[model samples]
Target chain A: MENTITSIFDMNIKPEYLFIHLDAVDNMDAIKQMAVNLAKQGVVKNSFIPAVLERERIFSTGLQFDETGIAIPHTDTQHINSSAISIAILKKPVTFQAMGMPDSKVNVEIIFMLAIKTAHGHIKFLQTLMNQLQNKVILHNLINSTSKKLLINNFKSLFNKEN
Target chain B: MKKILVACGAGVCTSTAVLNKLKSILDDRGFKGKYELSQCKVAEVPAKSSGYDLCIATTTVSEVKCPFIMGIPFLTGRGLDDVIKKILKELEK
Candidate 1:
């Protein structure tokens, strides 16, 4: 064995996991597409799609940011082979029911699909990412980045020293 | 210690993030040993909420029997101060 280990901050988001200017009619379609991509990449099992969609139907994931709207759709640990995050920047915003407010809706432009293998593991990484989401400059950079290389670099840069 | 319930969609991802953030805030305010944290799925909140002093969740929950707080502030860091204030007031009561 190589005996290599990875930290959540150091986890590499493969270029294949990044999708930009994607088109989806609604949150379900967007999530389905992202889950399909993750499955094809061998990041998640084929069951990830229905599990995630069902989770979202009961518990809304939409977050309306000061600059743009976003959603973090995720499910429990059973179907994941490893931990990975899939990024999808929609071509046009889709309506997603707001988190903690099922009746409310948000026009979400970005999606962070989380495939976590442990219930409590990698929480620090999520917190760090959430804090970065608060910064409009970073979200703007992510939204406008043209290539997968740039997008992955932008995400990694969020964990840089200054944070 | 008072029981504090923190739940999300599947009890996996965001709930833990929010729980960690909430713990740090409570620690800073001298709340150590003043409360105990429990993590659960949103679907379990209705049956379990009654035993907890307060419930904080990232997803919409129905039929919660205890006082509830919206956990989005902890995630986004927006209006966090107000959320903290509300938490403090609730804890005090």
Candidate 2:
């Protein structure tokens, strides 16, 4: 079994998990709902929800770049049956109890749901993730990207550079 | 001089993003001072922000006080200017 979460670029669209909408609830909840919907699709497993919640409870996974906050949700390996990721873009901002600064709230705009199958994968996956976060140019292109294929390609280029 | 401490889940990824933006903004805006950049887990954040003028987190952290700003926007420079202004305004005091 592969012990790492696939990079956003390596992930193929499940089609069912891909959703674009103007969320009505608190933006945070809207993003969580996206994970839940994906869970129900048998994309991962039922345990994924609590795992996500647990991770959230431990610390906020809000990806802060610029004033834009991207909420990326993931759980321990024990919680997942498969490895996948979901991305949800909110039409408006919602207040979230941000990490590090509980007193400050995060006005979340983009949320990426990460589903990991194992803890070992977690480390490797995060390593790539961290590298990607360093380059604002790539990040800008990612946020500016519209099509999923473009998104994936942009991400894969990182690995290509590793060769 | 504004004292800022920026941290992310691993300290390198998100926190670095936060620091780069801040350095750019502060430089462009002509503000300078001592700043600290490091990576840490959420559990360590509470005890970490001390003697620091401001705290920047890309993940959830609590049990610490001072001005806390999330680095989410800094990742893409999406809604960063206003937030940088907000933090700078407070630190300028």
> lDDT (0-100) at residue B27 of candidate 2?
77
Among incorrect, acceptable, medium and high, the docking class of model 2 is incorrect
lDDT (10s digit) by residue, model 2, range B24-71: 677777675544444454456788777677887776566767678766
Clashes of each: 0, 26
Q: Which stretches in model 2 have alpha-carbon errors above 4 Å?
A: A1-16, A21-24, B1-93
RMSD, candidate 2, Å: 7.9
Q: Each predicted model: what fraction of the native A–B Cα contacts (within 8 Å) does it retain?
A: 0.78, 0.24
Worst window of 10 by summed lDDT in candidate 1 chain A: A1-10
Clashing pairs in 1: none
Give model 1's docking category.
medium
- Please report the candidate that would top lDDT against the real structure: 1
- Local accuracy of candidate 2 as per-residue lDDT tens digits, A23-140: 7377547656876887786776777676666667665665455535656666555555667667665656666666545565667765667665543334434445555655767656
DockQ of each: 0.78, 0.15
